[model samples]
Every structure is written in structure tokens, then in C-alpha cells.
Target chain A: MLGLSQQALLRLPWRRSLESIALPVIALTAALIIFGGFCAMAGANPFQVYGSIYKAAFGRWSAWQHTLILSAPLMLTALCTALPARLGLVIIGNEGALVMGGLAAMATGLGLGITLPPLMVQLAMAAAGMAAGGLWIMLAGALRYYRGVNETISSLLLNYIAIAIMNHLVEGPMRDASFVIKPSSAELDPANWLGAIPGSRIHFGLLYGLVVCLLAYVLIQRTPFGFAARIVGGNIRAARIAGLPVGKLTLAICFLGGSAAGLAGMVEVAAVQKRINQSLVSNYGYAGILVAFVSRHNPLATILAAILLGGILASGGILQRSHNLPDATVLVFQGIVFLCVLYSESLYGKFPCFREGEG
Target chain B: MAAESLGLWGIPLGILAGTLRGSAPFLFVSLGECLTEKSGKINLGLEGVLLMGAMSAYGVSYLSQDLVGDFWAPWLGVLAAGFSGMALGTIHGWVAQQPRVNDVATGIAMITLGSGLAFFFGKPFIQPQAPQLMTFDWGAWSSSPQVQAALKVSPLFLLGVAIAPLLYAFFRSTRWGLSIRAVGDSPQAARAMGISIFKVRLFSIMAGSFLAGIGGACLSLYYPGVWTERISSGQGLMAVALVIFAQWNPIQCLWASLLFGGAQAIGPTFQSVGIDSYYYLFNAAPYILTLIIMIITCSPQRTLSGSPGALGKSDHT
Candidate 1:
């Protein structure tokens, strides 16, 4: 009976779309319940933990500021995964691209110094960052298309190399010398720092994220280029048969993804951190991959996913303070949610809810 | 025991020691990955498996000691680590077998799940002491304590070494192994022959994860011999790259593991000599070496030449 129903479910059209919307909601609810169980096992009241998390994440205007601030980098870094995923590529080197972009941005900002106008210097920094990150990720794409190396492995390896290069520079050639306790590069001029949005504590980086995500959505969903990209992603053979530039599309999409991550790094440095240091290696890039996945690789949906994850991250400290939970409690929750999302993708079309004669 | 006695010669000696110690995790993890990839699946969550294994082994060793004796405690810890890895493997394998599931993405999700579970449970045990594995005294003939110490090999390493040849023979001579190979190389052909691709692939995956868990045990129980959150610095992840470089050959995994171990030892060896200037650069040796290996060995012309025909981007695994 179950197998017959599954076959019938596959024959329906609107049922598929309905499943996509319903499945994720059900999956997220299941994940929340599982997380509550885990919290209980860890000796905390699940309800209290959930309450604290809610209060910390979205309770007040000030709390929203923290969530939005954290969401900025996530929105950008998530693009690094979401964009390439559209081209049927799995690139997880957002961390590497971000690191290289930040490093390049730092060099460009420091190289220009106070010689140029602050706005111009910041613009140059953004360009350099995007270029570095783009090229960095593009290398993985090139390797995949040209050499047949697995993009996932190559990208992950690049992450370590980028971090290594950052560490070398910060400890050696670019060391600021003032920080005896920690290794870091020279700070950018305060005049050149990214300012907050009008009447709010949120930085301009948040605007950059929203605009970029919007542009990316339009680029992938509306533009002819996006159509071409989807064609290449949907079927490489059909793409080749249609005389589409599969290799170029693959490389370009990868470049765009990397540039998004790189911009996140630049935003982190210029907006939040005034200097390049060990603090820049925060797992924003890794977390962004989760955002991309939870959003099902949709650039626009990434906005919501990033905010969701950002709220979880913001609640980390609150959970720790109120529930005496470990800081890793947030990670546990994120991981549970991610697993649930992935598992839910498997259940599509399994449940047949066909309106009578509407099939 | 004196540092001066091993001077000048100490670098190579230290490298030998490091290679013996560090290579165990690499060997076990790669061998496990080799087994999975041989059946046309990849377990990228082995990093999480490794961490989970490390955390569980240390925790079990500490907790089980009061129930059992010291010797039994560490052994029980090893057993628990394998079972825990198998538990995760069950999840990954089940999800992987579902239609339209991307193995790469599932592997990534499994990684997050494994690490989160490990870290949440691993926090309390980080500060506690656990019993370590027994080591063999191969260097007993040498008068130098450093030489004797360097020669002490973990039994787990030998087990890995022994398993390499056995695994090679299994794939070469055993019926079940041949079935795994057929399923991995050509799922359609295997399906035509009435082989259940689902069962074979699931078994290979779970067994592979079991080995990876033991590799984690080799890490926390043997070499570093302690529980720390940062015990593994991507060894589980790198092992996958290592397996690719080894061309999925089980015997080749051993040599590649030693090479990886030497690369891992570069920074520590230099630091031992107080040459810590480029410490971070040298620390990236394994990743750099893996990338270089991939670039050199993995060209379109040669890709999957020795790999199971169905490996990477395939729906089956």
C-alpha cells in the first residue's frame, strides 16, 4: 500500500510543490523538538533554554541589532555556497575566499593609506577583496572543469592555505608591533572605517549584504545569464548540445560565489574589526555553508536562513548565562537543524495529499 | 632521555617518531575511506567521526575504568568509539541510500551532526584523564631512551598495517569484496546480476566509519594520548584527499600515510630546533602537500583511472 501510494504521489504535479513547502516546516519542527531533548539530556530545562534563546535573539530592538550585525557576513558568505550550487557545484571554500579577500582588502587599504579619499579607499578595498576572493574560488572551479579535481576537496584545502598565509603575514611582514599579546596587522584609519546606518547601530555592511543578495537573486532567477547558468546546472550535456558556454558559466558562477564570500570578509574587517587579526578566522564562512544549505541554495532564501542562524548564534551567550549550557549548545542546535533539513529533502513526494480530481 | 644525546640526528629521529605517531590516524582513516570509495561512496564526515571517536574513547576510558580494570577500560573505550562511529555511519548510510540524495552534501551534514554531538558530550571529559593504549618496545635493543621511545609503536598502527594487506587480499580474493567492487564500479551491471546495491554500499560505509572511529582512537588513546577539543586538526578531512591520492588502493594508503605523517611533522621538528619563525607556514604542510598531490595526480586524462568507476557525482553511493 505504501509503495503504491508513493508511486501515485510521484504522478502528481502540484503535490510536488506542496511537499516542498510543507516538508521543511515539518522538518524544522522535528528538529526543534530533538534539540529540546538534547538540552534536557544536558541537564537544562528545554523550555527555559528555548525562552532564553528567543529573548536573546529577537526580544528587543537592541537584540535585533546583534542578530542583524551577525547576519551581514552570513548573508554574504552564504552566497559563496548558494551561487556555485546553482551551477551544480559544491564549493565549501567560503572560509578560504573570505580570508584571502580580507587579506587583499587589508593590503589595498594600507597601500593607499590616507593618500586617497576615505570613500575611495573603502571602495578600492571592496574591489580588491572581491577580486581576490573571486580568483581564489575560481581556481577551484578551474581545477574542476579543466583538471577534473573534486571542487569540494580543492576548496577545503585552499581554506587552510589562505589561513596559513594570513597567519604568516600577521605574525611576520604585516605585524603591527603594538599588540604584544596577539599578532595582528596595522589598523585602518578611523576616518576610513565603515560607518553605522542612520539612527541605528547596524553597520553599512548590512546594506551591502541585502543589496548583493537581491542582485544575486535577480542575476540567477531573472537575467538571461541566470537562465544560461540554470541550463548549465540542470544538464551539462543539454547545455553543451545547446552550444552554451558550460566552462565559462562554471568559472563565472564560481567567481561570483567567491567574490560574495570575500566581500563578507571585507565587511567583517572594515565594519566590525578595525584591523586584520586572528579574530577574522571566525567560522562565519563555515556557518554560511549551513545557511546556504538550509535555504536550499536559494540566494533570496539565504537572507531568511542567515537571520535564523544569526539569531541562534546571538543566543549562544544567553543560553550560557541563563541555562549554564556550554557555548557549543548553539552548534548542536545548528547541526540538528541542518541534519533535519537534509533528511527532509529526502521525504519530498512521499506523502500524497492530492485534492480529489485535482491531479 | 637527554636532548643533547639525540642532537643533529634528532630531526630525523623526531620525524621517525612523528611519522609513527601521526601516521596512525591517517592510515586508519584513509583505509576506511578507501573501503567506502571502493564501494563508490565517500564519507566526508569522517572528520566528525574522528572527533567523536576521540572524545568518546577518552570519555569511555575514564568512565569505564571504575567498572572494569585499567587495561579493560581503554579497550572498552576503543570499542565504544567504534560503536559510536557506527551509530553515525548508520545515519549517513541510510540518508545516502535514499533516492536523489547527494553524497557530498549528506557527508557535510553528517560532519556537523557528529561534531556537535561529540562536543556537547565531550565537554565534561576534556579535563579528565583517560588510560592509554599499550605500546610495543621495538627499540629495546637501542641504549638511547629517545631511540627506544621513538621505536615504541602503537598496536593499532600495526593492526592498520596488517589490515592493509588483508584488505587488499579481501578485494582481490573474497566474494563479498568482489561484490562490493562490482557495485562500486558499475551499479547497473551489479543490479543486472541481482546484487543489492543498497545493502553492499551500506555495509561498506558503516564498516569504513568503524575504522575511521578507531583512527580517532589511535589519536586520543595513543599519540597525543589525551582528550582535547582541538585534538584533530583536519586529519579526518585530509585522509579523504589522501585516499584520492592513493588512487583508492589499500596498500598505497600506507605509504601515503607515512608521507602525510612526515609532512605533519615538519613544523614540530623545526620548532624543536627553535626555528619557529615560519611556524604557521610550516603548519600548513599537510594541506599544501595534499593540494599539490591532487594537482599533480588528478588530471582529466587520469581522473578515476584507478578509482571505482562509479565514484564521485554518482547517485548510487
Candidate 2:
């Protein structure tokens, strides 16, 4: 019995991976309990709320379809923070990047006016979107680099400005006269809209999002440039001592982050909405911050985080319908998850079984 | 034609009213943040505090108006808002104090939590007619009804104005104020002098949040006089930038708040005068102005002129 107990305390197999996965799981379970308790306090059955969330998020292929579509944008927007975070910059400007990208794509698609082939028009719009988004975030990076401004504040402020600009365009300059009820831009040519993947309800944007996540992983974890960025993130003074081109790296990474988010915006316009409107500035950008944090800024891990959040988001409608709960019920759940996850960081390295114990 | 005729006079009067009302929230939030930051911690979660304050104030006022009478209900609401803010503030301060926790990340999470709780509990308060606090008449000299209406000043605004100079004095002379300044400028030195960094930060953050809650009351119980999900509208978040513009000085915070309020007033002022053109553009003014101010104030050469040496250290860690 003594030997068995000593063995149990000594180490666990695949200790590092197990600890990481275990900690997050524990945190998530805590979040579930807390959220359940909150629901009960708010005059609902906790079990039923959980049951409905599970049913809405994963009960059938239809729910899966909804989650998949919602997660596509989340993946791209998550990169908006994930990349900048690698350089130790806390930027929350994903919303602005997405908004600008959508506006830019709308303008490009309208300007093309079916003159080009559908595929070519799509490519042009994507390019325009990525460029606009890249430049938008790059401006924040430039401010941080040149002007010593706090990137987080600047990026957040940019989101408001971006929304204001979007409102101006859709409500004034880009407003479709016929659609007087809603402030919205003119719709794009139907042929230019992105087609769905074969036999699936999901759009071509899913492929783009997956591809970009893979590319970001390789870029941040593999390339020399990424290595230098890591070095910069680890310590700016040390990076400067090692002679990394800090300014260029900062601008380039921010641009990439913005481009990814911008692409998500283009995807939404081309795949789902087909027109720019107030709905385009949904809180996906804000949610992306939580995703990036939950994933610990690992580009590949962002996919899982996005999907989880997307599942929570997809359930918001069903929750309101079936549970008589407010739509923000999901937001409350997400917030609890975020807090639990962040707080659980302190729990790491504390478990005797996970550590190489002295005993 | 009438609105066009009233354009010049009504525009300025309307802006004055908006500024007086708008400045109250900004004043409270910035002042609260100033106190927190002055004690060497930056609470990015003030937005959440602001929202929670707004929600609680509205709910309390709505629920208590019948029991406490309308005159006293709003005051009680303001008090409840402060306590609600302290609750969230306590969460932030406690959790952020844990080792290995990033203050910035925790703050972001706190925003989600604060706003989440507000929305969750505030759903009932929406559509209820809460008792609104009375505004003091400051336009007895004016004969125009519109002018008299526009000249009405919230008592909270005057109180905020009064607090600024008082805060400036507290920072200048008091023992606790000097200690707060000491902790902010150099925590190591403060530690050597036997100050408990945890207690000071936690209390300062709570006090700051207490004020932010009052700012929220200024929103729901006074100015707009309604409870809604969208009432705060980033005003809570914008106050952080305003504090930066104020350079950690309470007196400067007052002017900065007025300037920001003036910027916000532009859109509504224009709409009131029937010059609705570029309304969206004008609404964007406060954010744009904040960005511009941050650009001018922050520098690459050295630390900001009055920035606390220990400010934001936890975020990097």
C-alpha cells in the first residue's frame, strides 16, 4: 500500500499533456457548476438549462451545422488577438478589422459589378478585405511602435470608430434606397456570393478559416520570423539586444492578425449576409478575445476554443426558445468559463501527481 | 424652419445640457480609475463596473420608489449601485491578487462577468419606470422654457465637481493619500516602508469601483432616466483614456471629462438643431478624440510624465 501510494504521487504518464488537459477540464467543470448555480438563482432549473444547451449545441447534425458556421468567423477573429499576443501586444481590435474588411469587400464587389468572373470577383474582394483589415490593425501597431500608445486601448477605441464608420457608410453613402426600414448597404450580385461546400450547408469560408489557422500555426511556431517574434514577446529588451527588427515584426504580425479577421468579415458578407449592415458588427470580435485567451494564444488551439464558444453561441437562440431564458444567458456562461479558465492558471504545477514529486 | 431658426441658440444650449449630464458619468468613472491607478493598479474592468452600477441603480430605484418615496428612492439606488460595484470590484481585486494571474486578462474576464451579471439581473428592470433624481434649476435668469430646461444641472455633477478639488487636496496632503501615491510610484519602496501592497490595491480598487457605480447611477437614475442594456454605450471604457488624458490628476480629470462630454455632445447637439448630416461621423468624435489624446500624451522616449512606476506590471508578468 505504501509503495502504491508513493508511485501514485511520484508522476503520471505523459505528465505535461495530462496536466494541461486535466487543468482545463477541471476549470470547465467548475464553470459548469457555477453557471448552473447562477441559473438556479435566476429562477430556472439548472439541469434543464444545461440539458437544452447540450441539446442545442450538439444533439444533432443540424446543431452541428449551426455551430460550424458560427465557429468559422470565430477562428479567424481569434487570430486577430492570438498573433498580436505572441508579440506581447494586447490588442482587442478584431471587431474593427472585421468591420473594415466587410465594408471593403462590399465596396470591391459592388465596384466590380459582375464585370469579372465570379471566382475572380471573390478573389478580388478577399484581397481587398485582407488589405483593409491588415492596414487597420497595422495602424494600431504603428501607433504602438512609433507613438508609444497602448495597443489595447488604441485597438479597442478603433472598434468604436470602425462601427461608427460602418454606420455612416451603410446608413448614408452605401444605403440601398429600397431597403429603407434597415440601414444597410446595397446587396452584392448573387453570383459573386460564396457557394457552400459540396453537399454541406457550411460555406467556402470554413476552408479558408481552417487553412489560415494551419498557416498561422506554421508561421508562429516554425518560421524564423515567428521565432524572432517569440523572442520579442519573451522580452523586448532581450529581443532588442539580439537585434530583432521589432518594429517591422510588430507591424507585420498585427497586419496578419487584422487580415485574418478581415477575411472573416469578407466570408460573412460573401457567404451568409451578402450585404453589410448593423448585424455585421456582432460581438464575435469581443468573443474572439476570450477564445485567444482560452487557447493561450496557440493558433491551432484557437480552433477548439472557437468551436466551444460557437457552440455556446449557437445555443443562445434555442435557450431563449425552450428555457425562457434571456439570450445573454450564453454570454453569462461564456464569462464564467473565461473567469474559471483564467483563475485555473494558478492551479498549474500544484498537483503532486502531475509533478515529479520529491517523495 | 423653426428648428433652423433655433439652430444657433438651441444648439449651444442643448450642448451645454448634454455636457453637464454627460460629464457626470465621465467624471465619476475617470475619478475612480484615477484613484485605482494612483495606487499602482489599472482596472480595465471599470466598464463592467459602470454597467453593473447602471443596472443596479435602475433596479433599486425602480423597486424602492414605492417604499422609500421618489425623493429618497434614487439616493438609495445610487447607494446600491456603489455596493454592487464594490462586489464586482472585490472579485477583480481578489482574483487578480493571486500569484501568476495576469491583471489585464483578469480584467477582461471581469468585464464579461460584470456585464453578464448586470444583464442577467437587469432584465426585469428594463421597461420599469424608475424614480429619477431631480435636477437643480440653474437657468432662473432665462425666460425661455427650453433654456430653463437645458440649464437644469444634476446634483451628482456638482458633487463630482466638488470631489475633484477635494481629491486633489487628499493627494497633496493626507497620510493615506501619500501612501497611495507611494505605492503607485514605487511598490518596492513602499514595501520596504512596510505597506501591504495587497490591502492598498484591493481597497483602492474597491473605492474606485464604488465611484464608478455612482457614475452608473448618474446614467440610469438621473440623465437618461432609464434602465437598458445599451445605456452605458462604452462611456465606462472611454473613461480610461480620459484618465490617461488627465495625467493622474483629479483636477485635470474634471477638464478632461468636460472635453470628452463636449465631444459626445456634438452628435446630439447637431441632431437637436436639425443638422442631421454627418450625425454618425459626429458620434464617432469622442473615440477619435481619445485616440488623438493618447497619441499626443504617450511617448517612446520615456515613461508618461506622471505614470505610476508600478502601473501595469502585473499584465506583463
C-alpha RMSD by candidate, in order: 3.9, 3.3
Judged by DockQ, which candidate is best?
2
lDDT tens digits by residue: candidate 2, B1-317: 22345658777777777788788999999999999989988788888999999999989888888999999999999999999999988988887777667677777788888888889889988987988988899888988777776678999999999999999999899988988998888888888999888898898999999999999999998888788988988877787778888888999999999988887888878887777778988989878887988888788886678888887665322
Off by over 4 Å in 2: A1-13, A357-359, B1-5, B315-317
What lDDT does the true structure give each of the candidates? 0.88, 0.88
Complex DockQ per candidate: 0.56, 0.66
Worst 10 residues of 2 chain A by lDDT: A8-17
For residue A88, model 1's alpha carbon misses the true position, in angstroms, by 1.4
lDDT (Cα, 0-100) at B252 in candidate 2: 98
Candidate 1 lDDT tens digits, B146-172: 889889999999999999989999999
Model 2, residue A79: C-alpha shift (Å): 1.0
Off by over 4 Å in 1: A1-18, A354-359, B1-5, B314-317
* Chain B global fold similarity (TM-score) for predicted model 1 against the true chain B: 0.95
TM-score: model 1 vs. ground truth: 0.94
